[model samples]
Target chain A: MIRIENVSFKHRATPILSDISLDIPKGGVVALIGPNGAGKSTLLSLVARLQPLQAGVISVDGLPVDTTPSRDLAKVLAILRQDTTIASRLRVRELVGFGRFPHGRGRLTQEDDAIVDAAVAQFDLTDLSDRFIETLSGGQRQRALVAMAFAQDTDYLLLDEPLNNLDMYYARALMRSLRSVADANGKTVVIVLHDINQASAHADRIVAMKSGRIIADGTPGEILTPDMLDTVFGFRMRVETIEGKPFALHQL
Target chain B: MISAVSKPSLWTGLIAGLGLAVLFVLSLAVGVSPLPLNKVLSDPEAMQLLAVSRLPRTFAAVLCGAGLAIAGLIMQTLSRNRFVEPATAGTAQSAELGILLVTLLFPAAALWVKTLVAGGAALVGTSVFLATAHRLPPQQPFLVPLFGIVYGGVIGAVATFAAWQADLLQFLSVWTNGEFSGVLRGRYELLWIAALMVAVAWIVADRLTIMALGREASIGLGIDYARMMQIGLVIVSVITALAVVIVGMIPFVGLAVPNIVSRLMGDNVRGTLGWVAAGGAGLVLACDIAGRLLRYPYEIPVGTVMGVVGGAVFLWLLFRRGGHG
Candidate 1:
């Protein structure tokens, strides 16, 4: 379980996350939904220990984020942020193999190689494996980055806006991959998503934030109402039931 | 990811290594006074010449090249800019500043003493460069190195002023223009530390490669980003200081070799480190050999040749289509 308590973060006097508390139990998909600058990404970063906890307590699997050794914490949780700017010229297989560094201390064992191959296959990146990262299209590159995080084999995966460069087709494909990974491996996937419908379709729970505070938290069916969407996004949107799932018509 | 045609395969490494070995023998032969190959078995003078000057100069050139290139690789990774290196980042100038300060205090200080102080100074200066580069927008990759060149120039200007005041201008000239004429066996042994630093880089090549993924990805991979950064700083500083101290400034080996090697072999340091080391050594040897033969019996400083050649390469890197950012 990832537990966050009264976590308040300020970036040079501008409150980014203010007194936010949330409990994310293991083994399910939880989507954090909000407008831009609503602290969804910041909260995910805190839970994954990407940033130092400034105000309160955060623990993953009962180990406090601030105190736990990063290596130990990494074994349990892995995070993939939106800014995935790679500096070096690296091949896709090599990039995915790096995800095994935490486990093997830079040397990939046979087991680690198998895991990497599995991740490469899982993301359907077999053909692109030998190509350099810079040569891939933006969506393919994002998929490669996701494949790397998946290869990490951490129980809790915190992805902040992983769907950024992906097109609609690949975006749905990625969502399905994450959903299957969570279900098959019993991994806790905490994703910050901008698409409400993607969240509605794949997410087991939707936590909505507005102004650094949680405005709504429940199953997608309970939180996708027009009134709840307005409270979180600060605008009203029409909602319709499609295949027993709430679909918000926010774009039209 | 690019599917580069040149992978660092065994044949690639063997060919590069063989080429460097040939260059090494060639360097030993093309000097002002040739040690007769036939007389070397019976001639003590030839042996003395070989032991005293030829071997030391050759080793120093190779070590200097390999070390600076490795340092440049680390610096580029740390700054996340392909163009940044010790010479441009104020590291070499800072080492000069430290050596000047030490010379003023203790004119007879040991070379090691000067080296330690210079390395420390270089560390501080490079840290400042790293911090400043971080604040600047990384999207504009050229800006970081432009800032570094300006910053290094300021430091270099100050060092020049100090040398002028102390009437140490001649000393400055010798150190600033690198050549092997002054290298006797005992004088050039300090560059071996740079050889050692290269080994250290090899041992930690994987970690350094991970750093190229940026701080967030590196940390997520269980690396302590700050510690790896510190390691990078130390490697660059020590190598820059020692190279500057031992044979003076041999520019561009660090900058050019890493860039070219990565283009050929990709940037997985485990695979590229050997090629980088070989490429660096080969470049300096080739430049040094050219310096010796350009006007036979009257040598040009290797530093001058490198500056001219490296400057041209730098411009090409900037202007070429499909060039790196």
Candidate 2:
């Protein structure tokens, strides 16, 4: 379980995240949905300890995020951000291998190798394991990045907008893979998504934010109501239910 | 057929092997006074020069090159910028300032005293940059190095003013020129400290690599990003300061060598670091040899040649980059 309490963050005088509080229970996919400048990324960053908390407390599985040893935390949680601009020209296998760094440092054990290989296979990157990351397409690179995170074998995975730059086919494939990974592997996945339909179709819970605060949080059926959508998004949107899932028609 | 199918480790070993052989030959054969191969073996004068002057100097060059490259790697990792290096991070300038102050304050201070002062100053300078980076808004990582360069320029102006007042302006110029000609027996031993720094770099190379993938990724993995950065930057400053004191400022050996090696070997610091070191040593040796050969008796400083080569390559990279690869 991840708990955030009374978290308020500011850059200079401008408050980015104000008086935010939430508890994310263990397991399943939790989709964080918000438009641009909605503090979605900032919240994800705080949970990952990317930026220090200004006036709040966050804990992951009872361990304080700031106080815990990083090596211990690395074993439990891993994050993948949007701007993955690594300077090294590492191959897929090599990049994925780094997920085991907190465990083995540099010298890989047999278990480490097995884990990396399994992640490569899981991401359907087995054929491209030897290929350098720079040579891969956007979708392929996204898969490789996810594979790297998976190879860490963490229980909780926080991905910030993993769908960026991905084509429609790859994007759907990635969401499906995440859904399966959560179900089959029992890993808790928190993903920030721009596409609300994808979140509505796939997520177990949808967390909506606007202007750096959580406006709505519930199951897709509950949160996708027109009134809730209007409050969170500041506009009315038609909601359609198909096969027990609510889809918001906000584009038109 | 067996030889044609080369293993990855073998390829790495082969590159390292070739680098060592070339470095050895270059160290022995090229210098101000040429000794015949036969005479080099038997003559005491030739052997003494080879042992004391040439061999140590070559070793110093290799050590300094490798040390500076590793330092640059750590800086680039800590800063998370491709263009940033140890020299660009105000470390080299801080060391230069330390040297100037030591010389001006106490004219008869020991070499080690000056080196210690320089190393400490470099560490402080690097720490200041890290502290500022923590406080500042997250921008392009390269901007940290640019800001560092600006900070270094300001500090450099102070050093220049002091040097001019002390009538040691010529001495100050030598820091940027980076000559190894005076690196004989007693003076060059200080570079052994840089070799020790290489060992330190190896121990923490994994941490530095983890830190390079942005502070958030590292912190998410349960690593104290700031502490790791501080450690890496300190190591970078110490090695750079030691290198500066021993042979002045060898520009861009840090940036160019590591960048080239990572291109071929990939960017895993643990995997490519050996190649980075070997390639750095080979490049410095090759440049020094060219410097020796270009002018025959009156050699151009290796630092000047490195500056020219590094500047050209950097410009080429800037102009030719079509996309982030």
Residue-wise C-alpha lDDT for candidate 1, range B167-195, written one tens digit per residue: 98887776667777789988988899998
Tens digits of per-residue lDDT, candidate 2, A6-108, equal: 9999999999999999999888999998778999989988888777789999998998887777778888889998877655567788889888877776778
Model 2: residues with Cα > 4 Å off, grouped in runs: B1-12, B32-34, B37-42, B86-89, B128-151, B322-325
The Cα error of candidate 2 at residue A107, in Å, is 3.1
* Best lDDT among the predictions, by candidate number: 1
iRMSD values, candidates in order: 1.9, 5.4
Task: Give each model a TM-score.
Answer: 0.98, 0.90
> Candidate 1: where are CA atoms >4 Å away?
B321-325
Cα lDDT tens digits for candidate 1, A1-252:
999899999999899988988899889899999999999888988887788888999999999988988889889998999878875789999999998889988889999999999999988899988888888888889999999999999999999999999998889988998999899989999999999999999999999998898989999999999899988888999999999999999987
